[model samples]
Target: MLGKILRIIGIILMGLASALMILGGIGTVCIAWFPENWESLAMMAPYKLIFQTAVIFTILAGILGFWATIKLARRKPNGWNMAVIALLLSLATAGTKMYFSNMARGSVAPTNMRFYFSLFVLLYFLALRIPAIWDKIRFEGDQPDEGVGGLAGGAAAIVAGGLTLTVHLWAGPSHTVNGINYVAYLQTELLAAGVGLIIVGLIPLALDLWKTAVSRHTSETLKIPVIDNRA
Candidate 1:
């Protein structure tokens, strides 16, 4: 019962995060492109990159968290992994944004929305780590082979990282004043995450391959007939 409740809460938090991200993204875009008086909003331009980065980070992590929790409810092993990653990403991105917001604005009050969201994040991570909760969602039945999937995922991540890096390069150097290229730095961080994803995806494949090789070698060794010819 507790697990179920936790799952429901997690799903709700992720959905709320997604909605917040969408709204934030829309606002950011409008602020970036639609301001009629550029001079009036010139002060806002410097922080545009931060908003954009937040938009991407929030949207991606929120959506991923939503899907991952759903998968967890359905008892898929990969779901836990994805959920963990999503939460971590959310921590890094949303958490950072929240921290800055707290600094720029005022410290979040215990009754504030940020406080609730932070609580939700903490609770969700804790729920996910509970072995009892995991056992409740444990997938039964024949497991699908992950070798192909891992390889595919790895390849996709590598290709995506390469493409993202290329686009960042082609887009030209990020706007810089006073030695800060916030957008560029965020993009580079994203590129690094992509590379990390590639590595993550590859690990399962490597393990699978190693296991297959070892099994084959053992089977071959076992197949060797004991030469009773010495008799």
Candidate 2:
């Protein structure tokens, strides 16, 4: 019963994360190409509030998802490490974002902040892939087909991560482009790609949640013991 509830909660949290990703993605894309329009958007406190809220929610969902995965994998001696790494990476990304935001101010080049943000975003995607790799390696014998879903999900994450990395590379250290600082432009691009990848990544997560719930239901009905009962 507890497992079922946790799975349900995970599903809900994943959905919320997906929604936040979408909002963050849209905001990033809009601001990337039309930074001037940001002032207008910012004027709408609700809109800005929503974007900020999405960031916070994504961080929370990431933490919850990581925790749930670790709990589910407790029986598996080897998987806990991957879950822990993912959790740490997610937290790091969120923490770095907060740090950058705190340091950023008007018309100032956020060189260090942008670099760290990009690096952390890359790590976030990489960390997310750890579980998929572990699942593939650990469950291939018992569940020959089980790893396929995670592999696909991992591939998607890689693509998203690659996009973010590209944005980061294009956004080099403070430089000049058309009288506008390149760092500023890079910041916008990186922000857009980061949010976009996060949004895209959420789709697979939602699917994973749905699949998890279905699997849980099926397993419950079968009444098969998953582990040794010996004390």
Clash list (residue pairs), candidate 1? none
Per-residue C-alpha lDDT of model 2 across residues 2-71, encoded as one tens digit per residue:
3333323332332333323332333233323443454432333333443355355444545554343433
Residue pairs of candidate 2 with colliding backbone atoms: none
Error of 1 at 226 (Å): 68
Candidate 1 per-residue C-alpha lDDT over 1-231 given as tens digits, one digit per residue, 9 for 90 to 100: 554455545544543443333323332343344333344335455456675676576567657865664454344567656766765665565555555545543432211333345356656656666786755423222444334334434443444345334533432232332555334645755567557645754675688789899999999988967668776
* Residue-level error in angstroms, candidate 2, position 154: 3.9
Q: Report the lDDT of model 1 for residue 120.
A: 65
Write down the lDDT that model 1 would get: 0.50
Q: Which runs of model 2 end up more than 4 angstroms from their true locations?
A: 1-144, 149-152, 155-171, 174-180, 186-189, 222-231
Off by over 4 Å in 1: 31-42, 98-119, 137-231
